[model samples]
Target: MIHLLMEAKKGRLRHEDEKTSENDTGFATVEESALGKSIGKMELTHDLITAQALVFFLAGFDTASTLLSFLTYELALNPDIQTKLQAEVDEAAKAGVSYEEILKMKYLDQVVSEALRKYPGGFILVRQCVKDYKIEAERDNEKDIIVEKDCLVTIPVSGIHRDPNYFPDPERFDPDRFSDENKEKIVSGSYMPFGSGPRNCIGSRFALLEAKVLIVSLMSRFDIVPVKRTTVPITLAKSVNLTVKDGFWLGFKNRNR
Candidate 1:
């Protein structure tokens, strides 16, 4: 990169004259900051490109790692849930699950969904209000809530995910909450391990797919079991991202497959 800078200064840099259209910066929004949302046309500078690349690597790696840790922790604690998931994956594995097959694995889907609900990698979602918004008071004598233009809005994702009204016995590691019969009962705008709406995470499906595949592969070979090092009640890290502070330690006993 320093060499490129020197070459650019000397007007001898290769591809200096080459132009990439605004659409050419692939996946720039993958790790876009919630607070500093792109408002209008953006310049694709070298620094911007470098920063985004770093964000993609760091954000994707850490977030996925956290999700997997929570997933294993939850599974280890709940042997019943793990067994069900394993059974489902085992069934799917008989034919060597293709990308399409994994999606059709209902129990696996439920397990992953429940895991995200239990421990979403992103605890909060932030949105900038471009225009004034209002929420009418539900009861008389109560005033409506008003949000002015340019105000930043914060949504507590983890809290909503665990809300008793939305999810009964929210702390329970039951995947049935996401089952086909029960999933319809889930309120829209309530579940969002990945952010919802237009500006939501672009890689949400990809992340889910990756997790499903990996979990299936792991479960097919071994059982997720809790060990002495694993925390009884996992504590959230006090960092900007959602993670277990003590780290997610679990045992993997080989299955009798």
Candidate 2:
């Protein structure tokens, strides 16, 4: 994959140079092919070529799949929410939800956002200081601290998401928090399911889009209900990992006929 990308990059550069040389003429005889056009946009910089391919192979699927699993679990646990979501999906179906329509779905976005908040795929993010930073003592017991350049810092995403200060009744799986009326009240920099600022997950949009498509399709055709073995208030068991004493047990009941 890297080799192909590198070769494509080289071809793209060569093509661009050719175009530049032919600028004197009103018309340049460019190759009439689709691959050439595609190659023109392919990027294979030393920093990104290998990493891009590897991230595509791994990062995209795992996080989105994890989110989907928990979304199913959440809906199963809250039958009322599940029914409400299905009703919303039913309306979208009546109106013919296209790609644009799916994204604009208000309730769908709320449910997905709430799921991400409840079960962040990556619980934390790490960053390094580019320069020296000073922390003034905020409490009497603490002293001023200096963090020099390149010092690593950890940000706890789950802690922030679950904090009652930011989210009232943080334990409740309520999608209304992300609704149009209530979402504006969310404290800035409080929700970090995909980290924050510039270095956050690059594939967040892709992940959300994939999640929405799967959920919309599933809810439109079936119901996510708790089975006999399903556990409620899914115990994190004093562990942050998405696990219960009894594993997530959900039932998918077909709504058709």
Candidate 3:
């Protein structure tokens, strides 16, 4: 992932250099061709570009690490699910697996989704109020609850996912919670694995697909089993951004034909 980021940075620099050369050689012209408006743009500073690159790199790394942790925990607890996933992968491909082929594994997709739901990396979504607003009182006799500007609002993802009100018997590891018919019953803001709105993670699709591919390739040939010293109810690390607790440990046994 770091190497990929470096490559992207190099490509961006090359493109900027080519743009500069074009401007110098009169190959490119800046014209005001808009809706009767002129907009001025400034070149991004080196520090700003570097910061942006670091943010993206960290985001990708954190997301990938969290996903791997989730998969590890699930595989450790449910050996049968692991075997079933492996069978799905074997049935999906004749020879080695391809990216397109991994996409077609519906059961694998559900497993990944269930992992995300069970242990979302970001357990809380936080936001600050931009303007003052008033919410209706819970009881008919009470006054409205006023929320002043700049008040911090925290949406507890872990709590929401475990809430029996939204999800019936939420503690169970049931991927069918997201099945077609049942999924429609999920409340709007309650099921935000990648968050919602335009500000949500843009690379969710890529991240999910990559996870599927990695797991398919892994489970196709090996069975993951729990090793000693690993805790049963996965403990979470306090310092990290994701849900990873003590590092997940597992043993790999190659499947015999």
Candidate 4:
């Protein structure tokens, strides 16, 4: 990947004499965009540009794959939900599949939202304390815990998502939880599948679009079903990223058949 990026960078650099058509609004390559740019008085270099490209590639690829895997698993197990989602897909197909049409898919959005809630790519969020902070005891007899500056704090995102307080019967895969009416009732900070604040996932919009597009394309032609090898309750592997123990085993039945 690094070699390919370097070759692309060279090509872009050599194309200084190329003329674009009037209709073409050519975009700058990562290397071109960062070359000679100043940030905090530090000029960007080729190394930094390549590193950033690598980060974008890896982060987007792994997280999106994980999300799609979990989504298919859920669909295979929940045929009712799969049928409902496929109905939406069929309706959309009549008008043709496009970015604009995908955005207007309410049920599709709800289904994807529920999948993320169940299996968030990032199960934990970590942050460093810039200053001392105090947390008051929740119970009368409990002692307060003081977090010193420079301390690292980890938020259990998966735990919060599965907590019954925020989402009743959290383990169940129900897209209605994200329906227009019920979605509004969810508390802020209770759901952070893509983290929160300004430092949230940069490729969130792209990631969601990719998932929607893939799901639409997949469901339009085939039905996701469980085969003999499929696991009823998915066993997650112990790893930094969420993944099935033996990977996802799903059968795709052709809709036309």
Measured with C-alpha atoms, the lDDT of residue 61 in candidate 3 is 78
Deviation from native of the Cα of residue 212 in model 4, angstroms: 0.6
Q: Model 1, 38-134: lDDT tens per residue?
A: 3443445678657756676677778778788888888888888888888888888888878867777778778778888888877888899989999
lDDT of 3 by residue, 16-67 (tens): 2223322121100122224213333335556766787778767877887788
Worst lDDT run of 10 residues, candidate 3, spans 22-31
Candidate topping lDDT: 4
Best to worst by lDDT, what's the order? Answer: 4, 2, 1, 3
Model 3 residue 151 lDDT score: 98
TM-score of each: 0.80, 0.78, 0.77, 0.82
What are the runs in model 2 whose C-alpha is more than 4 Å off? 1-50, 237-246
Instruction: Please provide, for model 4 over 108-194, each residue's C-alpha lDDT reduced to its tens digit, 9 standing for 90 to 100.
Output: 888988988889888899988889999989999999999999999999989999999999999999999988789889888888888
Model 4 C-alpha lDDT versus the unseen true structure: 0.81
The per-model lDDT (C-alpha) reads: 0.76, 0.76, 0.68, 0.81
What is the clash count for each candidate, in the order shown? 0, 0, 2, 0
Better of 2 and 4 by lDDT: 4
User: Higher-lDDT candidate among 3 and 4?
Assistant: 4
Q: After superposition, how far is residue 123 of candidate 1 from its true place, in Å?
A: 1.0
Give stretches of model 1 more than 4 Å off: 1-53
* Model 2, span 28-52: residue lDDT tens: 0112334444543644588787788
